[model samples]
Target: MSADPTLQVSVLLPVYNAGRYLPEALESILAQENICFECVAVDDGSTDDTADILNDFARRDARLRVLSRPNTGIVGALNDGLALCRAPYIARMDADDIARPARLARQAAYLDTHADCVGVGSWVDYLDPEGEHIWTWKMSANPAQIEHDLLEGGIGGLVHPAMMLRADAIRAVGGYQAECKDIEDYDLFLRLLEQGHFSVLPEPLLGYRQHPASINATSNRGARTAIANRLMAEARQQRGLPEKVLTPTPATPESSQLEWIDLALLDGNWRSARKTTCRLFRSVPLKTAPWQALGKLIQAALGKLRIRAGRIRQFVSIF
Candidate 1:
């Protein structure tokens, strides 16, 4: 399809079973100001109300274009959406994340002035499932630093959903790679870095939601780490640099127990959380880093307190 001469940006939103957060995500895009854009929302065979929501939104707004297909994972959904994008710039978005109103405007403006930059991302306010602010995730704005980090097997300031990519530059790199899977964004950023310099806006422009149902939470961490290590090795080899010995961090039983405890707290299962915490505490003495275990336990307790306090505030506000 030919590029739309009138549109300045194309919001590429690939959605799965994200019915709970889809409306907010769509509203964020539709509500963006000072930028002419089209939202190409691809529904990857969502069994939930995702398709219905998309259809209703599309009927109300012409800019939101809905495309439905079989469940083909994120990489396939992204590439397919990439093909349908009608603007020179493609802004990536997730169905569960909320973009700030000025996100598209500022990003589009930055790209307009920085001709050397092939892609740009911004810092994001990390949000919990209930839309509560967790913390601001800051990314380095320096291209040199970003490249260095990528070479060292880090993400290099390119937060996937918070990025605005040059359509041509992304296409040149062949979009998202299927082999990369869970680490697809990291791989794409590495390849995109070769085409032109990447930049990051220092300010937070998106609300990045982290929940149990998120891909990162559900994916195999070991496999992702292995893929990332391999990509870094390949990148170093291409640059004629010495290969760094990278090892995937092994998941300890204590860490798994802590995660369960955290989830239990989130779900208001105090009894289960107490039981798991006790088990974890017992196992900690056998481990090498006793202090680290204690620190983690304290952190988990603090998180639980925060969640409870937030719920209390919400309940109070209701009256």
Candidate 2:
């Protein structure tokens, strides 16, 4: 370990209604190894006992610092924390998630080795409140791969709770944007990509908690998708891409696959549906590997085309 004080890192965690799991989350950070860091916990006017929990923890540990303020939502809270951060590097941790013991150490090591890499995350194992492992999402090990994947989806592809980056780099990109507040991490990653590469550790170093009240679980997916589509449009404009490319086309050759899969299944075209389903199964691996594959196979077997034309006509006539 380098005995350099300038390498100190600041861990910023913005708290909302996170009373249920805040203690465990805080404990995870306190247990981190091989890193000299400060923990900044900002309470975003949580109506729950979140503030009380933060106070109790702050009293116990000198390393843990707490900021209590009115709720301005996550984006505001994060930006506030960002402005207050004094360390050279900043890491993000959600109040409801658990960071593996090596989370900080690993991220700090990577940033130290590759000074050009602005940000780094790691593969994560999703867990429920009781700490049961539900699924895993792998992330990009190379920053270039992350950027390419972002064009298709979001770079830092599947972001985890344990993310570390250069504070200055984030500031340079104008911090986080409110327009993309809901998808702030993705937006920040895009901006960071312009400055330097962002990569993730191959091994799972973060245990992300998935609860009913979590942002991803509670937010409307349709609305988020719409917002993401808009961001893509704006991003194209920023990059000077053609107007045609800037506008989201009506399902490209890539999306056509999904359309065909739906049509095949509805038309009871088992062969076609099976082939398309197989293509999807091969392309994307689900978290529940066995269950998802089995369900897809069953759907392929019972393709909608299996229904007789006469029965369909009779049902339609009755309606």
Candidate 3:
């Protein structure tokens, strides 16, 4: 048995014609401090200079292992890397994203402290190609909360690139399901949540690069929708949850619009929320839509109050 109690996480990076961003991503992973990790770069037969980049990195560092295979999609490449990983933990990093230097070390420590957490991730900063900050994505810390929020919309709160999984637990879930090809990470996360809890560091651990040529930009929306449906069904079955539990509550147009207003309020986005609420109140007929219209007005007022309170708190804290 390896004497080191700290799990040696194998960083799995699947490269497919990612010559531009591969070097920086690999460099950041290798620069992690106070941690022992194996960087496995699986090149899925890139027609560009991706192979050369991988080869150069492999030759320079013993920790960097290159697996060159014929052209396969991201799902296949990830599965292949997982099979060859010898570590007890697996950390996934996208070829196009930049992982912070402390990402592995922090997640490793979190897992070590929390035995119940089978997987861990952190907030991600979305950046344009020129490295301009777009927005901050904050994920739910509570497992139940995350799952509940996911039912209403996307569960991609914990970005895939910043995710680290327990090797055995992942295998137990049958690895990534083939049916969820493009949305593989989403499917795996839902399954992982069913078996064990998740932890988010509450800080940006990865810089997600967004560009026009990115795969997600041109991905088949119809295929992803199909995969999402299957994922929901599997999660429900595995968790022994009732179909009604997963089913989204049918909301009237006014009521549904109110929900969006509520979300904006909670996130401190007041102007947009108030504007939307005002529009709904003016356009919607009061007698027929009394409950919804009233609810929107109440929520909108509360949103303004919340914003005022937040500003007051900030001002006091500064003093």
Top lDDT model:
1
Mind giving the per-residue lDDT tens digits that candidate 3 earns over 212-265?
456565566566766677667666666586553233343345554455455555
List, residue by residue over 121-239, the lDDT tens digit for candidate 1.
99987666667654576879999999999899988878999999999999998989999988999999889878998999999999988665566656677888888988999899999
Give the clash count for each candidate: 0, 3, 0
Which is superior by lDDT, 1 or 2?
A: 1
lDDT of each: 0.86, 0.73, 0.76
Give stretches of model 2 more than 4 Å off.
Answer: 1-7, 158-160, 237-319
Ranking by lDDT: 1, 3, 2
Q: Across residues 1-319, which tens digit of lDDT does each residue of candidate 2 receive? A: 1222654788999999888889999999999998888888999999999999999988899788888899888889999887777788888999988888888989888998998888888888756545655456675687667766665455445473568989889888898887776788877776777788878888888877754446664565566667676766666677776433223234232244444445444544555545544555565556343344447557665554465666799899998
- TM-score for candidate 2, please give it: 0.73
* TM-scores for every predicted model: 0.81, 0.73, 0.74
Mark the regions of model 3 whose C-alpha exceeds 4 Å error after superposition: 1-7, 151-153, 237-319
In angstroms, give how far residue 158 of model 3 lies from its true place.
Answer: 1.6
